[model samples]
Target chain A: MDKQEEQFVKAYAPATVANVCCGFDVLGFALDAPGDEVWARKKETPGILISAVTGVEGLSADPTLNVIGVVAQKMLTDLNLEHGLELQLHKGMPVGSGLGSSAASSAAAAFAVNALLGNPFTTQELVVYAMEGERLASGSAHADNVAPSLLGGFVLVRGYDPLDVIPLGVPLDLYASVLYPQIELKTSLSRSILKQEIPLKKGIKQWGNLAGLMAGLLMKDYGLIRRSLHDEIFEPERSVLIPLFKQVKDAALKAGALGCGISGSGPSIFALSPSAEVAHDIKNAMEKVYAGSGIETKSYVSKVPEQGVRLVEQSIYQTV
Target chain B: MDKQEEQFVKAYAPATVANVCCGFDVLGFALDAPGDEVWARKKETPGILISAVTGVEGLSADPTLNVIGVVAQKMLTDLNLEHGLELQLHKGMPVGSGLGSSAASSAAAAFAVNALLGNPFTTQELVVYAMEGERLASGSAHADNVAPSLLGGFVLVRGYDPLDVIPLGVPLDLYASVLYPQIELKTSLSRSILKQEIPLKKGIKQWGNLAGLMAGLLMKDYGLIRRSLHDEIFEPERSVLIPLFKQVKDAALKAGALGCGISGSGPSIFALSPSAEVAHDIKNAMEKVYAGSGIETKSYVSKVPEQGVRLVEQSIYQTV
Candidate 1:
């Protein structure tokens, strides 16, 4: 461990949505605004250490299950860099709320560690590392959330072979209203319930929408994105688990959201709008829907944070 | 019908493949070196009239069953064009051979009539008209083949709402080897045999390929297009109808073809190559594969024709 260093590091990892309804395990983008923050300090020690943790409750009996712990260890191992670290993870977002809580933690850890190592990895490379941590939490190495969390904008995974990621333009006038109902749907269980096979016709529709969605992102055409946001395969079954899913979605649309749909594997829903004015109305509508169903919900009205994970503050200490 | 006219005006139609394998229906291009030619001339009569027919045998059974005849009538009705004319269609490409014979016929007739009427419509407008003709043949409205036929070049249907069609850069060095076995697979029947459902995992794979394919076309990257021309949904099931399908595909790959697969439907296959040398080798390999299987076949080696359908040559009809 480098005992002489004394700089505190803080970072942010934004929210993301996977699948986009029709493009399950394939398509995703960074939500405009709202993210988790993490701060850490380097310490002198003989062995790797996560001396502290917060904003995390009942995470896992095994340290390996903790996203930050796992990601921190992997980054160290991948770089062959040894360091004892005192970590403070601000779990600013709810756990398992389908807003990429796990991804946020992994991203925050990756960002801090990359900075600690002198930022040796590129943003996409960090995403690849973060996805490894996410896989420990969800049992799949999906980059949809991690890519956006690290890149801080609309990220497209063109193909995996030599992974091509496209960062697209976004309309500045819009803010997304994201809501999390009290209803809980475990990410692992939600994914397990899905059918292994889907209709060929459904696949066709999904591709068309996905293509249109990519185009919409590139052009920053809000209407095109909204009209193209369809989830023909995964949402039908997953939505049943979220109480009043249709009510919330319909209400969001009525409230002037360009479009609305479940975020990740929900209990959470997100609505797209041109401004906070529209986002505020959508939020109220969503709250009303949740209220009608006798469920408490939490919501955030914000824009997509274009700056991905970064070091906010850092410090170092030595014990000889 | 044109008793007072010196020469009888006639029209022809071409065959087309709508989906074009990987793209389903949204994307398609034209095959121009060979196509059906439609002829149209003024007549004393005030409506369309049919005269001598070539290539297509026994198409006179019903005017509705004849895709060309139906499209011509629809165009006339839609535009409310009132003129005396006779139509003649020369079927050059074999039907159900996966060479887009239907689209060729439809586009030929539409172009001839429009030319005879002084070109009132743009290329895109003609594509929509040709699609109506394809509907008569395949029971679906698709514009891929029609668009390329009317407007020659590779195209991207960015979206259908505004009907955006962006032309892509064509790779000059790319050549194709097409082999048609003396067998038939009706497009409708081919459409029917497909499984209606597709798995989400596979959907991701398809989109990856789609993106790669688009990038390859845009960048004029032959290697990329070859590596990405994977048709996950249609090729496997349809390839069964082509003799020695596996062997032919293997030989083509071994002989320097980047990638090879079933073209349009069955009984025909195509390979992508970077040069004429590789293309000719693929042709010889395909012949070897089919000859051993006791199937008579014809082959054509050509580049992506930069031009679609046009009036190749016309003998001027003097006023009687």
Candidate 2:
């Protein structure tokens, strides 16, 4: 057997925008900035450990409860590896902010550990490992966030049976404007407020919007994209929790933005525009609306990131 | 003022396959054979009239009760032409056989009337008129059937709010086998059997399949098409009404067919194959199973038609 190559590795996993407009739990894409990083190092012990956690306060140092630690342990157990590892998590994004904070951490740790272990797993397999960590936080294994964070670009979680995710093509001119308000919205809390049963009449329109959205993305038809970026069922229910939701959306639409809706669940609203200039304009418009509410907001305008999780640093030890 | 151009116009509207697998109420495609035709003649009388109905026995002679008459009345009132027209109904497909029999008749009448009026209406507008005719027969103004029959080829009824129907590209090698059993199934009765509320879990999978189906058609990925042609919500409820539904579907899949399911509602089953040879094999397999049940069945294999409704003949008279 070949000796272990990398003694230490660091990886970055970008934050994701899940449920893009009408897609609900089926579509998501990764962002270029405001992500999470993890640095992993080999240890002599047989159990995985989290030696440090940074950027996010009140994070648990106990490996059993931490997302990075949980996912690393699962990967090692699956591969039947006896080597131990220590993970240092640096959270650049806010927690409980609908920015996929937990998913970024889980994806980074899975990716960093896999790189440290000579890249033993495929990217898809790493997604499963990251999903294990996501289940630690959301109580369910949903690939919407982790898939994009692992696979990069726009990703569709086509089916859960056998875990199939298809990478979708993005239009060249598409840009995103994300605004994270200073309020905390837990993923589980936002998910809990959604209705379990929607009326059958609305379901037909939702499916149509979804199909139209996919076609629009593939065909690069901006008019169809503008018309189809509507979620009649879930958006109405979730937007009720956010203050001034309709006004913000209307402002974004009035500023030449193609479509505007919630990013994942709530508070962090995203607007998709045809150009980066328009995306910045949307960001400014969104900031103006939140200015009067005494709510401090952080905003970003970015393109869809081309790569997902990748090793930033690696040191391979060659066997003689 | 321009003199009347077309005194008599005859048009043909092809049969359609509605609710293609997972896209219930949202997707359909037109077939080339076994359709309905209508002949319209402008008259000096004040009211729209059905002069004669043929090709289907026991069809109503009343203009209001018939699909052609109702649609023509709606069109004349909307246009305010201050003229009357006579329509002859010719039904080539079986009634209540789940092969979009009513939509073919409705589309032919709508197209014939529009052509008689010098084609004032756009094709999309004609879809709306065809939908009116469909309402008379199915009790619901759904465009899944009418849109495909009016516009031709694979079509997606993206939304009904502003009445949007998108014509999707079809793969060149895709062929369909449609089998109509000698049994009647009412649209209303079949619709009534469906549950008003579906579980949220199934809703996600259904939307994924729908999005996947659209991508599959646009990309012409047959493997993706085979995987995505599954309806988790309506098909399970509606397929129970058909006899030997499971056996027929299994047999088709076993014979190298891509996918098989009830065409629209029940009493007609359709299978999609990658080749004409395999489509005929599926037809034979389906016929073999139904032969023992003592139910006479008729089948057809055809390509997705490129055109929808078209003028078969027209005679214009000019006044100097």
Model 1 complex DockQ against the native: 0.38
**i-RMSD per candidate, Å:** 3.0, 0.8
Q: Please write out the lDDT profile of model 1 over residues B5-123, one tens digit for every residue.
A: 54433333333333544566555555444678887765655666667568867666244666667777787787776666677788887777787777888888888877766678876
Winning model by lDDT: 2
* Residue-by-residue lDDT tens digits, candidate 2, B1-320: 24563478888888889888888888998888788989998887778788888887888979889988888999999999887988898888888888888899889999998888878998888988888888998788989998889888888889988988888856556888888887777877888998888788788899998888888887778888888899898888888888888888888888887888888776788888888899889988888888879788988887777787788887878666
DockQ of each: 0.38, 0.75
**For residue A70, what is the lDDT in candidate 1?**
77
Top candidate by TM-score: 2
Question: Model 2 off-target regions past 4 Å?
Answer: A1-7, A315-320, B1-7, B313-320
Alpha carbon lDDT of each predicted model: 0.71, 0.85
**What tens-digit string does per-residue lDDT give for candidate 1 at A1-320?**
34566666788777776655544665556764566776665566523455555666766523376777778777777776556666666777788888888898889888987777668988777877898878898887777778877887556665666665554424345577889997778987888888878777666666666655554554556876677677777788888999888988999999998777788888789887878789999999989877756787889887765766777666655347
- Comparing to the true complex, what docking class would candidate 1 get? acceptable
